[model samples]
Target chain A: MTTSREIRLRSRPQGLPAAANFELATVELAAPGPGEVQVRNTWMTVDPYMRGRMNDVKSYVPPFQLGRPLEGGAIGEVIASNDPSLKPGDLVQSNFGWREAFNAPASSVQKLNTHGLPTEAFLGVAGMPGLTAYAGLLRVAALKPGDVVFVSGAAGAVGSLVCQIAKLKGHKVIASAGGAEKARFLKDEIGVDAVIDYKATGDSAAALTAALAEAAPEGIDVYFDNVGGGHLEAALNAARPYARFAICGMISMYNAEAPVPGPANMALIIGKNLRLEGFIVSNHWDMMGDFLKELGAWHAKGQLKWRQTVREGIASAPDAFIGLFTGANMGKMLVKLA
Target chain B: MTTSREIRLRSRPQGLPAAANFELATVELAAPGPGEVQVRNTWMTVDPYMRGRMNDVKSYVPPFQLGRPLEGGAIGEVIASNDPSLKPGDLVQSNFGWREAFNAPASSVQKLNTHGLPTEAFLGVAGMPGLTAYAGLLRVAALKPGDVVFVSGAAGAVGSLVCQIAKLKGHKVIASAGGAEKARFLKDEIGVDAVIDYKATGDSAAALTAALAEAAPEGIDVYFDNVGGGHLEAALNAARPYARFAICGMISMYNAEAPVPGPANMALIIGKNLRLEGFIVSNHWDMMGDFLKELGAWHAKGQLKWRQTVREGIASAPDAFIGLFTGANMGKMLVKLA
Candidate 1:
């Protein structure tokens, strides 16, 4: 018998999630059934979109069930294998529940070899969020050379890659972060052309205008929308003709008890011929291999950099997860089990 | 010299345009300057988009310069021609301004020879607004067989054709109009599967839900947005996964001083994988001939239906234009200059 800890939703969180929303409990795991592999979870990824899953509303992804281990993208080592695809001690990634150990079928997990890359990167750089940023920027936004990319929520796991990928593709990358320090990391570390501390600006229109004029003197070609509302509106205004905006997340408008105000300048879209698309990462998994290969080379060359505000224990996962809206993390927010 | 009566924008209106903003100017025109043709304007289009032109703001097209003749799409008979491509008494379409007689270059006007089609059809179903609906529906929304389309301001110019075109493409069309008369026209003449009267319902969300249930029992595949606001929100709610929306116009928010309250449920976009696009007709002129051919065939076969609120005299152009937002037109609104 193996002892494993699991975090379950105590109650649905209203607005911003709190410590009261999550509760951890110990579980005893039984031996793996036929075609099942037991995973010893090592790393768990926290993302802004996961907050939406806490609500029991119909969305693209199903909502987290009450009293169930909160499920998300996780990385672990297969300690026991009943499936031939995996052997004991092989690392894997899956949409596994928030458990220290769990027996899942081979169908759920993707085996990870690392191939001289960081082990934790399977949940960050080459993970779902990473591929999301990659496919969205390349496929959805169709980022071209010399195109200007304005990424909202720039410090987060997805937006961070969006900015970096745009930069690597020869685009002038401009990003918005909630704090000055995070904005600094975006400009200094990631080589984003411009970073606006939206918190300091207090006005998205002004921030986007000033930042866009500096970053994209020619015009904005691609707007990778991670945060919606005012940022989306400002982008709409600054967008050149035939611009593409990939609506990845609306974290800005999420958790609002009332209707969020629409960006007043939406009328600009028709005249400007804007393409605004809203999509889910799960829909674009076919592009994953290409993304991993290219991103790995970039990582090995030090052309790509990743940041993590790691919560030391699974116990602190709730705070790190909730801190997303307030901009507590620099890059990807993750939890390490001790 | 041809004596021309013209409707000129004397001043920019503040909110709802009044008759006072326009002045009837009579200008004596000199003969065509070598390559020019003197056009006697017959039918002038009164469209909601003209409202945006009334404001001296940066729009898709330049604003109507104050004290200058307001220019728009019109089909006219060439009273006199000096160009090789055209002859006297030929029917042509051009942006010849809102004037009874104007001297325009031969390059500006395209001769429309009844070609077994009604001459007025050039100003309505086969012209800018009509081609706009076609391009936007097919090119942007990508409406396919069995797609469910919802058009707001459905009895109006662009929205009416959008509903018909979507239906012609084997789609279920749901329309929302301002009054009972417009609603009846949408169902009876427009052949939309369902109709919602905005005036009677008084609530966008409820009316849309009811109309959506009736017309799009399957789900909303495309949103033809002519009326923006809660209607956009309503369409967003009724959208299926990978649904497309063409933001052609936003009559609901045009006069709004502030941002319209949004669907607050926009986070649903991430879950649904929706595509909301904004387009212009000028960018899609290459498909004009094909559209005109198909629409003419549909008309000849009696499969296509149309109606127009012909406001007699050039002086009524401003009033007729403003009546668009008020749902004063049954189908296309054309200002007749006699």
Candidate 2:
């Protein structure tokens, strides 16, 4: 029997999750079944949307059950396989994460083709996050030629990609993030036209509104929303007539124990003629091929860049997941396991 | 010279408007100029949207200037004309309301066609409000064949037409209004599938959510938002995946002294994949021809029905406007000034 350590949900979170809400457990793996493949995980991702799955509620995806190993995206190498498709030592990707190793049907996992980039890029830049940014900015918001793009959480994985894509399309981009480091990274590395450090002012509401106005004097045509609360309000305040907003995620209110208030100026939506739409990346897999091709070209031209903040070992998985809420990672936050 | 009595905005209201904010003035009208026509007003409209014009803030339409006659849709008779396009006694419509008589360039007003409907119908059922409902339901909301529609302010001008049009297209409709009389009108006259009296229960938020759930057990595919706040919150709670909301107006928040809190569960927009869009009718005039054509067919076939709450003379215009907030009238509210 092979031994594997996996993290299980100890309890459902009340508000902000703590490490105690998780428990590390060991499982014994038998030989692979008929269509199953034995795999050892290398890297896994922890994202903000995972918080919603931790609760006992009906959503697009099923909630994570208590005392069960958590599931997420992971990159692994096949150890042994009974299936003809995947061979031993072949790298693959699957939704069997939070564990050192797992046994899943070969059909459930996809063979990894790195496309000349690192394997972890499949978990982030060139993977889900990349597709999310591309679909949201291009299709969901219907980005046009002269659309002034405004993105919240600008230094994060998906947001940075949105800014870069808008810039690539020759549109003026305005970005907002929390810390000084992120602001600098957005300005110097990503080369965004303007940056709003959301944490710099006493009255965050006024500051964000004024900062966005200064960034785009006329108004934003498209808003790629990641951080909702104040950012959504500010976007509404700064939107010109017929602005379109792609609502991707709201990391700011993910941990709320109760319902939080929405933007106060929602009535402005009618007078300003704005459209706000939300979408999940899973519902838009058709765009993956186009995304990968464009991303490969951008990568080859050295115009694409991404950063990783990784925590080592299976035991540190909970910390990596918790770090997302505290803005501990500048880009993609991942856990390395072997 | 002809004498005419008119109402002007004396000052902007702080919260809900009162009669003291208006002044009745006497104007001495000169003879028709080279291209001007002298019109004696017959009927004018008092809509909920006029409340937005009472504020000094900029919006889709310019704010009503203090010490000037408030401008709105009015049907009148040209008593004298200097332009060849119009003749004496020609029925016409112009944005020259809150007054008994006026002289304007003949080209500025359209001679009423009436389409075999009453002259006042041009200001209510067959006019701007009718077009608003048609364009908002068909184009903005993109109402599909199987869409279950929910309408707030279902007894009012725009919303009642939305309910009727959806019903005419053979879709199930759920409606909400304030009082028992409006509820009866919605159920008996409009033939909606369900009605929710928003004032029926003690906890309005819970009541609206439950009512909508019971009304649409499978969940609503489209929401026509005429009243915002609690209604919007209820719609979000009960929205199915890929639901579309065409935000026509928000009567609930128009007279606010300060910005009111928006829906507390706005994050649902992402998980539920909801689309909320706002629009102004003036921006959608291109849809007028299509709307009037459809409306004429429906009326000729005896499938379309409308009601009017008439307030007599120019002096009652302010009360007619104020009564909209207090739920004094159902269906199309108009001021008759012969």
Candidate 3:
């Protein structure tokens, strides 16, 4: 038997989760069972969607059970295997997060094709966040060439990839970031046509509208919404006829104590002939092969870029998740648990 | 030369439009020039969308210009024609509405194929509202057989057709209307599985949710939204995973003095993986032939039914339009001006 440390949900959060909401528990793991493999986790992802899972409400993904280990995207190495499919030393991915190690059926985890790239890339640009941006812009938003696209939370994981992908596809990209540093990263590094510093703006919606008017004078054809509320209203006001909005994460409202009121100008959806569709990355697994092919090619060609904000150790996972709502991370926020 | 009586928008309304905001004016009509025809109006249509035109803001349809005649679907007979395609006594459809008669280029008027049906049907069941329902369901919502559909404003022009069509497609239908009379029409005449009288419940959203729970115990797969605001909230709360929402209209918020807050629980879209798309019927004009063929067959077989509230004469057109906001009309509202 071996000892392993895991972060477990202690209680459901009211709004923003505190340290008291989670407990770092030590567990003893027995030898791998039939068709099972023992994994030593290297890296795990903490995302905005995980915030929703912390709540007890029913959602697309099931809520995190109290006193049980929190689950998310994790990349690990197979240390021992009772299954023929996964052997020792194989790098695999699974939804067994906030833990130092885990033992699961081999079928539940996937062997990663690192392809000479860093294994951590699978948790950032080449994983769920990357696929989300791909499927969202092309499939959901129906992005056409030359479409002027505005992406909210552009310095974040999915939003950053969306900006790069839109730019590479010959569309003019306008990106919004929470801070000046993040704004600089988008404009200077990501090569976005325009960058709006949302933190500096007194009225986010009004400022977003004014900035969008100058950046995309013809009006936005597609809006990739990662932040909802005022940003959604701004996009609605600035959308051209037949504009398409890929509704991804609404990180802005995830930690609100009270129910956040939606965009006041939602009637604009009818008048503007807009299509706003919400999607989950898990539902678009079929697009993974196509997404990987395109994204891999782009990465090889030096057309794609990514960054990571790491929170060391499993104990800090809760703080890392809570940090997401405050815009503390510049890119994909992850917890390294070796 | 001839004299015509017309209703012009005297001024833009602040909240709900009133009689004083319109002017009954007499205008001189010129005889048909080359390729022009003089039309004597017979029947005209008043619709909810016209309320948007009363505002000075830009929209899918152009705003009704102050001191100018309002335009909408009108059926008339050509009295004089300079075009070879149109002859005297031929019934045609034109957008020159709220008028007793008008002379326009023959190219601007479409000769209607009455096909032994009432000429007035061209303004209701065979026209824009019918097409709105057809394209909205099959194309926008992607209604699959056996899906449970909930339609708001169920006895109105677009909503009534939506309910009937969904039922014909082998889907269970839940319809909501303002009064018991309209609800009865939906249940008995329209063959909906359930009916919700919105007026009976003071809290529209709560009532709608409770009624939907009882009607569609499995939850709604498709929501055809003709009324937004609280109804939208109910649909959001009651929608199942991967539900599709075709946002055809938002009559509830059309005349709001201040911007109404959207559904507080719109975050449900993300959890349910919902697709809420707003579309205009004019954009899908290519589907007209298919629409007419299907709708005509249904009408011929007597599987489809429609009711019209006729406000006699062109002078009553303003009142007819105002009545739409109050849910006074059961189906398509029309104005008779023979």
RMSD of each: 1.9, 1.0, 1.6
Which portions of model 1 show Cα errors greater than 4 Å? A83-85, A203-207, A214-217
TM-score of chain B of each: 0.94, 0.98, 0.98
Tens-place lDDT digits, model 2, residues A1-338: 67999999999988889999999999999989999999999999998899999999999999999999999999999999999999999999999999999888999999998877889999999889989999999999999989999999888889989989998889999999878999899999988999998878422556789999899998999999998888899999999999999999988888998888888899999999999999999888999999999998988999997888999999999999988888888889899996
Q: Estimate each model's TM-score.
A: 0.96, 0.99, 0.97
Worst 10 residues of 2 chain A by lDDT: A198-207
Writing each residue's lDDT as its tens digit, candidate 3 over B1-338 gives 88899999999988888999988999988888998999999999999988898888877777989888999989999999999999999999999989999989999999998887899988988899999999999999999977899999889999999999998888899998899899899999989999888888644677778887888889999999999988889899999998999999999998899988888887778778898989889888999999989988987898989999999988999999999998889999999999
Better of 1 and 3 by lDDT: 3
Q: Which candidate wins on TM-score?
A: 2
Give the alpha carbon lDDT tens digit for every residue of B1-338 in model 1: 88989988999987778889999999999989899998898888877788888887877688889899988888888888889888888988888758898887899888887777666667777677789889989888888777888888788777888888887777778888888888887888768788878787765665766666666777888898987777887888788999998988888767665556545556667778888888878899998888988887888788887777889988888788888877789888898875
Interface RMSD of each: 1.8, 0.7, 1.0
lDDT of 2 by residue, B132-226 (tens): 89989999999999999999988998989999999999999999998888888889988999999887842256678988889999999999999
Candidate 1: C-alpha RMSD to true structure equals 1.9
Global CA lDDT computed for model 3? 0.90
Clashing pairs in 3: none
